[model samples]
Target: MSRVSILALALGLAASSLALTASAATPSANTPSAAITAAIADVNRPQADRDRDGDRKPAEMLAFAGVKPGDKVVDFMPGAGYFTRLFAKAVGPKGRVYTLLPGELATRSQKAVDGQKALAQDKAYGNIVPLVQPVNAPVFPEKVDVVWTSQNYHDLHDAFLGPADVAAVNKAIFDALKPGGVYIVLDHAGDKGSGLRDTETLHRIDPETVKKEVEAAGFVLDGEDDALRNSADNHSLKVFDPSLRGHTDQFVFKFRKPK
Candidate 1:
């Protein structure tokens, strides 16, 4: 073959190989499993939560977290039992979901605490356990399979809830998980290079800050997805502000403790 013909052939082969690698790495989001579907469709889930399903993407998030029957999960700071209830149903009868409520959050939002306790009593989601304790010290019932915290990850640094010793909490979470277990942190994103500065005012955190703190505890950054990201959000307003409440730009990160 001529030199130009040989070069084109080599480039095409490299492109084909790269395509195969990309295809292999991507998980199938189009087809959710039976367990995840049932959990999202559970009749007992409050309508309010169901309404927000489009924005929160619970099924996608659960599938991303790889929750399965018989897996033990720690829904860290599971406010209002939103993800907590979904987790309880997803894990099924053989599995368990611990709603890890901090003593600080209980003081801040008693209604959330009471709601969690009530769900634990209901037979439908009986697999839930409300584990309340100090923010810095996390004592899980058993080394868990997954420890997930949503929008509230930034609160661990805020004055209202924490100014919490984040390193201590991350270390505690590290110790509480089984080797190979996953730690998923989903939160709103602050502006570029802001680091932890926006956490208190915007209730948003720089994704880099989360990675640094989590990796310090010996966890590896496993995966991340843009499923919840909204490009329109500039990340300046508070997460709870009227215009930004449900549509804020968010990030989903999955970290794992190595075996």
Candidate 2:
């Protein structure tokens, strides 16, 4: 080959290699999922919800969860419908987002229950389905694509949630998912070795404890993302503590039911 032709081919190959590398890394993180981005930008989202976006990093977390259009998602213990609304939008018209309000929240306060019902009735994100799950015997209507709990998994071990049978909760989640479906547990991080010790007081639990418990229910650890990690958080303060409120160190785990 002529020297000029060889040089041109070498440059072309190098450019192609770089493009391929970038494409490979895109799906790994921070890449915009059209559905997620649209959901976040939806006009129906409350201003208060939007204000927390910077700290909560919903886009990154949603992307990590791998939510997509037409997915069936369970937003377990969906507090105030924050993620319920997001999931409904992200899943689009054909998908369904089930707001699994535990029995405590369902019966303890009528206002809370009414709020979820209200959200479900909204036309903007009419795909949301609201249901109350008994703490001890959680029930989901059908196998879904993803089951997710955010910042509240620790509550399952605390008194507020009947100190729910964590095992049963896990198993229900395992059963609620289709084979190969994902379960996402996102929560505040506790000190490395402290298992459930901090669940009630500090409102945190070690990341490993979550892995062990979920795995015990027959889920295989699939992937984890550090998108929400705040290294400066020492795992000592309550999640509501003013100094650490919005920026508390958090962990996001993805476990899959075996296919």
Candidate 3:
């Protein structure tokens, strides 16, 4: 072939390669499973008299937790049945989602009491089982693949519960999971080195403190994801102080029980 003809052929090949690369880089329209997508849509839909946005992150967090259609899951303190519904759908009909609401909350908070009552009757959440036991109680019928808690860890440090009670709660969760099971936690971020101070005022907790505490319970820190990181947060303000509210900086950690 002539030199000019050879150059033109090379250019054509390069153009084709570029086109293929572009196509490969573009995200596909393939969505999450129909069941999961539908459940997420239902949770995001606006409801009458509901003030807080669902802020559902199960789709993202479940990915981090490596939750599968057949994995058993436990949603600790599944307030208003938000994550409970998501877990129920993600685990599908074959898997189970135990919605473990602290028995203390059920007895003290009328809203929690009503929510649990409503969840018990929801047909859509047939895979969900409500376990109204104290946080320290091992009421799970079977070992779970994933034990997940979101925005509720800070409450464990409340004055109403002492250190022993909090430690017992963590241990109970540790015992309920199978060896190699995952424990995924997502909570508001507090100031670095603030210890548990944020738990009291801002309803947040230091990520370092959480790691040390869970490690003490025989959980290994598998990994952490920066998907929820927000650099703008100063971490001094309360999560509910209007300035932070829905956009507060958050941390996500994945711990595992050793097999």
Cα lDDT of model 2 by residue, 57-172, tens digit: 88888888889999999998777788888889999999999988888867788887888888889988888888887877878778899999999999999987878899999998
Reference-based lDDT, residue 49, model 3: 15
Q: What is the RMSD of candidate 3?
A: 4.3
lDDT of 1 by residue, 201-228 (tens): 8889999889999999999999998899
Q: Give candidate 1's TM-score.
A: 0.88
Q: Higher-lDDT candidate among 2 and 3? A: 2
> lDDT of each prediction vs. the true structure?
0.90, 0.90, 0.78
Pairs of residues clashing in candidate 2: none
For candidate 2, the 10 contiguous residues with the lowest summed lDDT are 23-32
Candidate 3 residue 17 Cα shift, in angstroms, is: 8.9
Cα RMSD, each candidate: 4.3, 2.7, 4.3
lDDT for 70 (candidate 1): 91
lDDT value for model 3: 0.78
C-alpha lDDT of residue 256 in model 2: 93
Model 3 weakest lDDT span, ten residues long: 44-53
Q: So what's the TM-score on candidate 3?
A: 0.81
Listed in order, each prediction's TM-score against the native is: 0.88, 0.91, 0.81
